[model samples]
Target: MNAKKEPSIWQGFKAFLMRGNVVDLAVAVVIGAAFTNIVNSVVKGLINPLVGAIGTQNLDHYSSCLSSSCKGDQGIHLMWGSVLGATLSFVITAAVVYFLMVLPMAKYLARVEARRKAREGTHEIIEVTELEVLKEIRDALIAQRGSVHDER
Candidate 1:
């Protein structure tokens, strides 16, 4: 009787790391980290300055006191400004990734699929026409064979 040995942890780990998705995920993480700097710069350089024209240049500086007679971190403070800045950064990043990367890739893949389907449709039509022609020939051959037998 033969017994199968289970894979060791190291082998399993090696397999996991070698999978295509794991490599793709690693690349995406590195690219995302680099992309984050660009988004932060856009927010700090452009958005913050535009907002600064109306108020403070930094969003982290803006806050609201929830309690009366509060002084110097002695009361409940709502850091809505930081939240707003983070929200803006997230929106900008998502828009850039979608419009610049995801949207174009989706469109390109769709075009490729359409071309493949068109080629397959043409091949199918040819096959069906050929089948019909073969059937017609078969019927004509049977008729000719029947006429020859009648003459006998």
Candidate 2:
């Protein structure tokens, strides 16, 4: 009797690490972190300064006190400016990722799929021709066998 051996833990771990999804996720995380820095810089350097020209230099400073005093967390302070800044960062990041990465990747994948299908179509035609040749060979062999039997 033959028994199949199960893979070792190390082998399984290596396979998991080598998977395309794991590599893709790692790349995505790195790119996301880098993209975050760019978005933060845009908000802090460009957007904040433009907003500052109208009111304050930092959007985080723009808050409203719900109570009489908002000093040192004494009262309810609605920090709308920080929320605005975060929202802006998120919107910009999403837009950039969609337009630059997601859109291009989608188009590229479509092209690759089209090429694959085209190759498969050509392979199918070749297979059909091979089948026809095989059928003709089989028929010729049967005919020759019959002629030999008739001569006997």
What's the lDDT for all of these models?
A: 0.97, 0.94
- Candidate whose lDDT is highest: 1
Q: Which stretches of candidate 1 lie over 4 Å from their true place?
A: none
Q: Report the C-alpha lDDT of model 1 over 30-112, residue by residue, as the tens digit.
A: 99999999999999999999999999999998899998856888998999999999999999999999999999999999999
- Root-mean-square deviation per candidate: 1.5, 4.1
How would you encode candidate 2's per-residue C-alpha lDDT over 61-115 as one tens digit per residue?
8999999877886899999999999998999889989999899999999999999
Worst 10 residues of 2 by lDDT: 65-74
Reference-based lDDT, residue 76, model 1: 89
Show model 2 residue runs off by greater than 4 Å: 1-4, 118-152
lDDT of 1: 0.97
Clashing pairs in 1: none
